[model samples]
Target chain A: MSESNTIPKSLQEAIGTESKKLSNDIEKGAIRRFAEAIEDNNPLYVDENYAKSLGYRNVIAPPTFLRSVQTDPLPDHIKSPYSAVVDGGSVWEYFSPVCAGDIITTITTFENVFDRDGRLGNMIFLIKTTRYTNQLSELVATQTTTSITYEPKKEN
Target chain B: MNQNLYFEDIKEGMEIPTIKKNPTTQQLVKYAGASGDFYQIHYDMDYAKNNGLPGVILHGALKNAFLGQVITDWIGNSGKLKMLEVQYKGMDLPGTPVYAKGIVTDIIDENNINCDLWLETDKGDKTTVGKAIIQLPKK
Candidate 1:
């Protein structure tokens, strides 16, 4: 069966699933710090007035800022016998801008699993994708991350 | 501002001054708060281990943020950062410190100054290899 086929019939499956509704409790100061750290002075992020004038309640976080949010605690499927979690890289597809004070929920689906070879070693790749929705359940963003893990070399 | 650094000031093997940052669970939490992410692997320790991670790991974007700070600080306000790209290599766990530093690799002259940047981090069992392209101010 396909790994996506293995998403589990039950929500309680050891593999993590289920969506957590998000809140806007994130600190504006931290957002400012991140913008400064990135050297991004885009008015939407740094200037509250600018953001507000643009209809935001407060300063906006960078698109990549989504990386810092904490999700639900559960066993990840990549750890299962099928495969391991590797850092394959992530690609974020933006459908809309993320504004301050916007509560969001993310629905994550265990996408697929595969394998590959490299000069360093054998690798297992796990594909996971998440969809972010605002308070109204309106879809906001989709992020897909591919993780790769190295298995020990087999002796010939 | 500090004096402008150029290709002439650096050598291929030369290390840029090391910068240290200790990001706390609070920092990560704040990051999550701002970024609107709720991934359990970043905060729930048991969840991470159960998921096959040693513990809640640091966000890769945080590493890029650290590297961005290093370059912007070195270049000052006059220079604009044209672009930055990185491939996530590994995870960074909480409490364990992560260090980001780089070496000068190449110098490209395009009206503005640009350099090839390499970055790395060691946090307990996880070590990451990263690289970037940064534009610097011309003297």
Candidate 2:
């Protein structure tokens, strides 16, 4: 990889090895809270009876709720300036519904690290890819979060 | 949803129904608590101003959620959101009227529909731009 002045050498060096895995249990409360937070009133997310009436195993989670199951892509104790990070955006793909009572396991990997010279200034960007699998070992979803790390402004 | 949208019912360029949301600081706080993203910039005005921002800005994730609702609401419960992609191009303020708008861009397959989506402020500011692939039942 080419030398990057903006991205942390530690971050760049940690790229494939920085993967982290975690599991979260899907519950009606969290799913309902997330749906309520977004102000989404979809019965598919909150009403178990309604969900089952619609042929679902149980009340299912909204698609973007998968982000809550993610842990930091970089392993804990890795020294890096994550405080400077800004939310870039995200991309998500859903293979199946995540229902209540599902134990969702996530394996997140640092997909890439690089620098982008933009109008603001040279900045570092990191991409983290996470795959979500259920207790049934079914791949439920995959998501990638892009974060940009802007250098802290210099004080005069 | 009382009605289901079918692949055979929509055209390549037809616009899906839009969803408008007005998010307040209270809502942002709720979102922060729910999503476990407790960044002060989303709620604490002082922290936001100290960071060179005009005011507490809407979380990019919240905008994504709005866009998701726009698509999911239009596609109905039978539809599957196969893919959702978004870019945080700009910022929006809290307690403002922002609309979730989208247009069907393509019929990728007999069952898959591609659409372009965005978040627009009442002042016509486009804060986020995105795309989605929805799998609809065939008619």
Candidate 3:
């Protein structure tokens, strides 16, 4: 493959593929752990009464708490030869608050692929999106991630 | 842990209060476990070095959370973050000071506020840039 046309056929075939998964009921302990890890002191994220005071059913997760919602990786059939991967970044659109006790379900879609010449050489940007909905079927949030994959640097 | 920010009190050019973070390797470990992103490069020095990284680097999700804190801490409890977008431009390593900063870009509907946000290195390099839209409560 030429340097300009580096995105492999496997990744291209994976586009538009999707997988659905469920998250553990949003737990107070998990929320608090994430909050402490980030050093956030917002009571709304850990204190149930405080969240209720703000009209939430229970302690609400932080704005970025959706990071805790883990999902299955791509199927083995769509493997890329790249050895190292890093996050390119993320975009989020939140429609409603994700509070504790909410059992969330995520529908993740393998969305797009692009190749760019980056600082580390030609890197493939793999885009995927996950939509989260609560038990009530209310769409809570949607997040898209850009994962950058490239050849690993050999040990010197 | 201060006064609540209201839509009426914000100006287009207003600078939101900055939030600083000194992410330790331990915090990175905790974040990896909490976020389930144990991708080796974030906490494994040898793995990182083998992959051309100088050392273990901070996770982009952690940077995202940091920027999220900057916005939520400024908007107070009543405000809501409607949209947040982050682009990781450079790798931020552990133990370095990162400043999460933002400035109000526009005020729409007399309630919705749009802003440009970033995670800046000590030398003023924006390792990560983002945009945010927040809705502040009426005063």
Candidate 4:
């Protein structure tokens, strides 16, 4: 297996380029579906009355619910040459809750690109950081994600 | 349905309550639909097996959501979850019980508490490891 650095110069040049996307107003039905998918019956994510009792304007979303909202286009430069890509990990920071009816927006930046040796062989990793804001332009949350791209070894 | 935990009520080294989750293939399918992540690895067992996975695996984001629940449920209504960071080290399969556990690692102040959290399989293999910071109401 070859171990040369696999990240293309074009892709490397994309680091720090930011892209933005805005989402539709968060919906209660969508939040409920997400809560059900995760099998969390938390009233904060499902029952509006329960959330109101907790002082929330409406049913709020789970911390990771933003995953369902950000529908955006990925810049072509971020795509890897390898056929397989695996999620390396993620770090998330939350400042405010995302309530139903709040339209969310995100600004994503290509943060880093690097290569490393792994059990399989040489791997290239890419990191992206995204900032999420609500309709009031309040910072809601931020997530940093790392992904690894590699070619599968050929079996004899 | 648990009682709210105030900052004064919890101490360092104390274990927060655990939330047990059993992710079924059906749930993964629903999660795929709700999340708009139509990646075949989460639903197509054969495709996943061909891709080096033993079988259909749970989505990493879904596991993160479970950890979020662990913190939010423990903090109750008054307290707020400030941050959650997780690293996916191992793959988890559907039909297995994954337990989300946490131990209070540091008391930053009267209002902030830090915890070391992880998700482990019934066999005790840690599938995810991370840290979380929660803001608890001062009593």
- Against the unseen true structure, what C-alpha lDDT does each candidate score? 0.58, 0.85, 0.87, 0.88
Collision count for each candidate, in order: 15, 0, 0, 0
Best-first order by lDDT: 4, 3, 2, 1
| TM-score, ranked from best to worst | 4, 2, 3, 1
lDDT of candidate 3? Answer: 0.87
What's the lDDT for candidate 2? 0.85
lDDT per residue, candidate 1, A39-115, as tens digits?
A: 45556567889668756677766656656544542244335343334456565554555666777666666666555
DockQ of each: 0.17, 0.80, 0.82, 0.83
Best by lDDT: 4
lDDT of 3 by residue, B1-139 (tens): 6788777888889998998999999999999888888889999999999877899999888999998999999988778899999998999999899999999998886446799999999899999999999988787
Stretches of candidate 3 off by over 4 Å are A1-5, A152-156
In the range A42-76, model 4's lDDT, one tens digit per residue, is 88888899899888889999999988876465687
Comparing 2 with 3 on lDDT, the higher-scoring candidate is 3
**For model 4, which pairs clash?**
none
lDDT winner, 3 or 4: 4
Docking class of 4: high
Error of 1 at B36 (Å): 2.5
* Candidate 1 per-residue C-alpha lDDT over B1-139 given as tens digits, one digit per residue, 9 for 90 to 100: 3445554454556666766667677767665555655677878879888877887877676666666556655654344444444466556666666665666666556333334443444523325544445444445
TM-score winner, 2 or 4: 4
**What is the interface RMSD, in angstroms, for predicted model 2?**
0.9
* A1-156 per-residue lDDT for model 3 (tens digits): 564567777778789888857665889899999998888888988888878987999999988898888666666655446877777789999999999899998888889988888687778888889999998899999999898888866758
